[model samples]
Target chain A: MDTASVTEQPVLAVIPDDGVRIVTVGLAVAIGVAYGILHWLNKRSSEESRVGAIIRHHWQPGAWILGILLVTLALPKYFTIVAITALSLLCFREFSRTTGVFREKTICAVATLGILLLNFAAIDNYSRLFFAGGALTVALLTVCTIPFDKPKGYIQRTALGTMGFLLFGYSLGYVSLLCNTPHSRLLILFLLVAVTLNDMLVFLFSAVGPKSWLLPHTSLGRTRIGALGALVVTTVLTCFSGMVLFDGTPLAALVPLLILGVGISVLGQLGDLLVAAIKRDVGIPETRPNSPNRGGLLERFDSLILVAPAYVHFLSLMLGPIGSDLPQRVITGGGP
Target chain B: MNDWDMQPAKDLHLTGIERSRSYVREAGLSESLIRWCWLCGLRNWFCRWNGLKIEGLENLPSEPPYVLIANHASHLDALVMASIVPRQHRDRMFALAAADVFFENPLTAAFAASVVNALPVWRKGNQQVGLKQMRERLQDEKSIYILFPEGARTRDGNLLPFKPGIGMLLAETGTPILPCYLNGTFESLPAHQKFPSRHPITVTVGQSIDSKQFQNRKAGWVELANTLKETIQEMSGKPAPEGLG
Candidate 1:
């Protein structure tokens, strides 16, 4: 008998699969189908009616839905940061372009570059100190808006400047928090999916429901039916997504998240309305002579700014701190 | 060419100077190049420099066979007009220039040819040749003729009497005329200064007037000329000339 035991086979360990890969693929397909259907419906609706006329009459609720969908689809993680940051810059640039805020409106171009740097800071979870600095810079800008003689103009500029900072700086800071969280990539995806669903539902509701003026004075005026529909849809989607992604979360924990989603959606709509009101008050035409129609940047991103801080606050409350080891179920209202 | 022009119409069997078609062709080429350059460089600069207060630019036509009649106060008036007219229509436009001034120097003459597309006119002498050339240019469907009907810069920076030549050209062509009022050019580059000073200028374009309305009226060339002067004066918020009713 050979001492080497040539017939003996080496033992190999069997790897058990967690089934995450399958679920991710399924989620992707579902999102793709939903987007395709929505796109087709939007196209069909536009063909049936004049888009401009429809928008002028009832745009707010639809805009809110569209904005939420865009934010949700973006995910706001490291990979999606570039896209989100680009949008943030565009929104701010458009706001400045339309409002004619800076003395040399060209300065907005440079400020957009600075925003990219801010986005980087946000992603690394480097320091809250940088965000604090940004807040201080905004305050200084507001002070600079003070007029030598006209107090009214001073106050107006200060308000406008402060709003710009809140929208561009503070709101955008949440994206950094998203990047820094443990399993941030997964959480961002969940948020994006939930928000997108919320946006779509809101849009559908607004389109079909009875028209009632939510804000009669502002350009982003919405109907009571539209608002109610948005809240219902957002809550349902948030709760549903929370259940599906997180296995151990309690129903009681989810109520706050649902409320937060509804509140953010409503506030976002109000921000859009505020921007439109500003343009209307200023009497700046949506289009300039020999130029294409660009309704101004501030008008475009009004809602995003309003919702960003609230989103950040909600995340902080749920997750404790951005870089902590809190499980997804706990952070997203899925766990007890 | 000079010898050929000296021969009498009877001997040559010619009917007047074969109305130099070359002048129109030359005008077209010169206007195009100058207009292109000005559009590329000077327009944006002028807009920035003056803060470009344009009141009624939309009223002007995109294509032109119309007369652009404006108040002339300084040499800078032409520059301002060139800078202000929409870039699209610049190439087809011509400004009437005094032969004694712009055409005298080689550099000035070349500039006048390329950029201004200047139609040189003798202010005093025989009006027949100048008037004939102007009328022919205006008659063309492709050309836009600009004339400072006051004939010369105003001494007091107020508009002078309307020259009869403008009325004669208008009567012959029956083209719509656009009245333009230029303010602050005199301060920017006053009549007496050689170098232009930095001053903001405003170029206001008034509504276009149809020549058909005045076509058959008893208001002969002189009366028509006075009417034009009055129209421009009213648009500019200045008083009409003293003696004209």
Candidate 2:
């Protein structure tokens, strides 16, 4: 692929304008089927057990997520980017609140501002500025909090702030950047549906498989077989979906599709584990605030945090640099 | 190097409305920012609207592990108490608000938790358990609590008898208690008034009482409450009513 060709203007459009309609419908159907199965199992299962009863209530949030996904598909590109930015900030708020980093008001303010700027760069289609966010965030988090003159928890707070910046600000902000791509709407839908399915499959597989722990300490209930099960299931599901979603592109080919699917599954699980690891380090391994072992937005979207960047990079490599054809510097109105 | 012992927020397990109405809800950076801004505006509001004046700020403790108790006459009393402290200590200041009144709904709960940084104290729930959590949070997090020991706003503009709940929080701890009286706030926004009317307000803060001086029991707490109530009544420049104590 000629990476330079990505800058060329007005390439004949291939994908239909309403191309995501079928994929969105497919995703809704998939969620419906899963919900039906869960409802069926919940009916048969005894609610005397705590797990059985709580898992029965899973459809509440499942319906909520489906509603959000459907609404996002209907919105404009900028709306999706703004929603993603808001998600990143809310997820960061959860992390900071959970890890005791919220105590440092200054560090949190800088991290929040950094997250907003990253998304702003993505909105502007200024990839260079978006790429520069990681360094800038760490630098600011380290330097800006020095005036407090209370160095007691300096290292801890700084480290927490940096990690939060990297995870929510830089990493998760990629979802906003992905919106700058030609295949943004369908692509986001594809990733969201796939990841949600992957999580459900992982949980389902763990309940029945050889009772084993993925990392006994980090996640109290995650099974090794469940992780492997999600990897295999998500790979196949995402690969088939990618064929339809990426029809006009080379990514529709079996080999590239398979690679894309595997990348997403592996990276998604790793992201989930990364969040699990943080909670473990902070002595709050698993919190069932609403659902069993499912926590706030951070826990729910942890997988998406990593998969977004990886998918963007994969698309950039397969098809030229992602979002290159889009108007450059929408905010600054300058060329690279 | 400091030992790596990272204690999460006390209410880490709670989320959303549950966290907001939680008695142990700890305000985060966002809430702190909102609270700071709210208090700053409130300071200006008190001064300009009510022509607010202060008598003894020098009597407040330099650090936390202290409680501020004042006669509750109107809704303005809590805001007045919270805004009196310096900006540096604003983050640690939390006012104990009546759960039914302030945290009954989402909009009011958000305001109570974020802007006011007030924790819900259920008047009819398990008082001992709630007070234990509040007391522990005060000491562990180095917090300053603004409490209205009168239990509820006075409807008739007469001071209510101090409840022993305040002593339950300070018992066995050396946390100093600052007795204060807010003159003219009842007239500004009395229990009957839906909205505050303009009235000059003057707050007189007495020196802290070593809570350790009182016994850590019901009788001792009652005695402590009466003593502080007497101090505040004296600050009101009212003659001690006979047989009230």
Candidate 3:
């Protein structure tokens, strides 16, 4: 419980160098093959090319894959935290713009400031403050309108602000929390690769496998076979990755790894569907033109948003707290 | 069932420079924050630099769902008019700026839209579509539009005859039109000048004019245009020149 003892414990000692190397090399090869295939397909096809259409549709995902890998490999934990915070801010912006929630300047301003504060708490490694920030933000948002006396859209603005803060601020803040943990690179890299692979595998299976719809209303392209196929593939992938990433931990066991694997994939898929449902409900074809092909930050990383918290908490529950033996509240000195 | 109705922003899909100049451009959190900063800067600049003074501030409508028309002479005219809007209605305010000028390029369009919250008003080629969108937005969104009925800034300081397009927006609609005449703006930053001089600028806001009785026709449009022009002229406290009548 003492901060001094925790600080002296070697957190990085748990990281297996071979596991990191395998994951990094595996990611590089996977991304390289995707780009190479895309290049070949684009060149091989004619004007009316199906591959061309597919390329046009998924260029953003390709870029995203490359970007995530680069960031994970090249950047430190601090930069990764900054990147996630940026992503959360962008997602919130897209959400606010699409939902017309941002029209409430006061609410939007407060939520933005609140999001920054949440990220600050995460960076500070103050879990207590990070957990407390959400409630404080919601309360602030609720009363932020009372002084304006513009009761007309008060409920709408407050609701939008709360939802935005919870989804983007608190939920996305989990990534930053994970970044602050011991062997964080391995854990975070696993999360990123697993989520991205889950999406790609689901799409591939849906395109090539049996054609029964998964959910006709939410995801038209997704099929039952594809969904289950992705589940199986993702579970296996997550299990392997977790085994390497977790190494000597209790999560490295077969049953626990399977549970983590299945949980990550299921939660990731649900997150994607949730965003799709939101877009449909709001009657927007896309959230924002994030790239030439797909929607904005949320669309690209929607799978990760829910998965971050679920995987993190699950890992913490099975194992002890994230970075338990590592330094506690590195910035805040573990005080009131 | 949930009674809380949620609507998405209109300009969600637009990207890059297009988002800035889009008629459907909706301000999100970052844009709103920047706009607040811009408003603060604009107010400070106007008061300290232009010696800005606004008359009949009480004549300004408390909420939106209305249009504010003014005499255009300088680039500063729009800024002067936009700066006078109260805090409650600041974010909702959209200044109708010429697309040919303000929205000709990405940078200027970004400045106009992000800083000024101005929606592009294309001067040529089937303007009705844009006006139709504006009209719909003005009514449905309960938004405020700061427009110059003259369509373009005058070469001289003289007020040009109001364009028919203003009538097109107001015809058959009960949307109130608040007429305001801007003085010393032309002297501050005329169309010919790039940088503004430290000339005093004054905005005189008159009573709001309702166009309920007017039909949405050419004849009705002419009447509405003339009425707005006369109100602006009177607000200017100037004798009508021989030919403008």
Candidate 4:
């Protein structure tokens, strides 16, 4: 497709009656039903079936997958950005708690302001402000602590605050950026599926494959065979999904899409491992016990953390500026 | 290079409500904001409704890692004590509230923990653990605890014999105990009254008692309690009321 056609395309034009989203929702519901039935059967047959444990553990993640699909389909493009920003804050709340940085009032205040500003930039479609937020927050945090003059945990608090902003505010802000693009729905659905599938495939392989260790210290559940299986399976799924999502763009070419897919799969797993490291370091079983069935919001969104930034940059590189054709600074008084 | 000693929040794994009520609860932005709003509203209510006049505000140490002990007569005692906490240290002030009364149910617990920034002192069970936890916090975390050594609210409008728990917390810690006396609190809102009357109340702040001189033992706790009671009695100009230890 030509550049003009790409820019002129309606947001839903590529979705084709929401075929991709429908399939995703259908697949999720089917899996959920199947698992629910199995869990019921096992409960009836035995008092303590290991299947019950598996179902309990996986239930929250399963619900989140279905929930995101439905929400993406229902919410307007702007609301989707808002929703993502809210999710970023929730995740950051858990991050602050686990990192003990919540104790630092100034750091927490600065980070929260940073998150709000980043979201504002996303909503305003002001890329300049969005890019400036991280540096500005770092500067604010550095200066914010100096007023207290405690100087005991000065460096620690500042660094923690900055990392919190980058991960939740700066990194997740890219999702809002991507969602504002012309074909955002398709792109977002593709992202959700790729990351979710990557994690699910890894679990499937690890659960059934040879009981050998991978990064036992980081994640005891993962095995070498499982890692290899996830890597290959994720690559294939990403390539296929990319083929559909990026059909008209230069990414439609096999090599670029393949690289993108593989990159997402690898990055997704790495993100999970990174969170695991945090849990282990913090000496906590889970990030937060906010939900009975699910781990913290961060746990559910862990894979997406790394995938979001990478996906936005890569797609932007392959296709020109995301949402560039959309009227820029819709709220901040600027033109496309 | 100095090692980066940063750790996750002590209550990191706790949910919102639970973290608010946690002994190790650390106030970040949200909690700090909530506490600030509560304090502002409480301050106004105290001043306008009860005619609260806080005296000896200058007596408070400019920082935390200290204890504030006052005579327990009504529920307003803790609130009155917490009101005098300097704005800078307000977020760090953990009011030691009665677990059964304030934290018996989830709703009250959420209110106490979130709005009041309270940590439950279970009057019935496992108090040693709670006192020990508070002691550790005072020493290590630089926490400021607003407590009543009288243990429970007075049945009559008179002072109760001070408990040794305060001494246990401060013994050998060298932590200063800021002895405050709240006058007319019982008249404003007695233990039995669900709603407070518009009776005037006064909070008089006195010099901090150094608990370091006392031994971390029973005899020391007795002496510490007696000294605190005497100081409060002297400030309030009321003889010690008869009560149990």
Candidate 4 lDDT tens digits, B137-210: 88887888898988888888677888887787788899888899899899988878998899999999899888
Q: Per-residue lDDT tens digits of candidate 2, residues A1-336? A: 554454553221355445456765676577667656655665676654423443532333334544664587568877777777777788788889878888788899999999988989988999899988768888999988788688888899899999888888888788788787776777677778887777666666775577788888887556899889988977887776666666776677889988887888788888888988888887764645344334567667788878888877887787766567788798888686
lDDT of 4: 0.76
lDDT of 3 by residue, B43-123 (tens): 899999978888988987777888889999988888888888887788789999889988988999888888889999888
What is the lDDT ranking, best to worst?
A: 2, 3, 4, 1
User: Largest lDDT belongs to which candidate?
Assistant: 2
Q: lDDT by residue for model 2 over B66-170, one digit each (tens)?
A: 888899999999999999988999988889999989899989988888888888889986888878888888888788999999889888666788888888888
Residue-wise lDDT of candidate 1 within A137-245, one digit each (tens)? 5656555434344344454445544565457755765655566554455555545444444444444555556666666555333466766776776666555544444
Q: What digit string (tens of lDDT, one per residue) describes model 1 on residues B1-245?
A: 11111111111111112212114433222235456786557667667776556678887777678877888898877777776666666766777888778766666766676666676777767977767766776675367777898888976777888876676677735687888888877777677888767777788888887765555333656766777777778888877657643
**Alpha-carbon runs more than 4 Å astray in model 2:** A3-5, A9-13, A16-24, A48-66, A220-224, A285-294, B104-107
As for candidate 4, its interface RMSD to one decimal place is 3.0
Across residues A1-336, which tens digit of lDDT does each residue of candidate 3 receive? 344433465434566778866865675465455456555756776744534443444345436644864475457777777877777887888778767787777888888888888888877777777888888999999998899777777777788888888888888888888876666776777677777777766666665567788887776657888789879977886677667766765567889889887988898899888887877777755312234325666667778878989988986676556655555577878553
lDDT of every model, 2 decimals: 0.57, 0.79, 0.77, 0.76
* Predicted structure 1: clash tally: 7
- What clash pairs does model 3 have? A98-B8, A98-B9
| Complex DockQ per candidate | 0.02, 0.57, 0.45, 0.47
Worst 10 residues of 2 chain A by lDDT: A53-62
True contacts kept of 3: 0.64
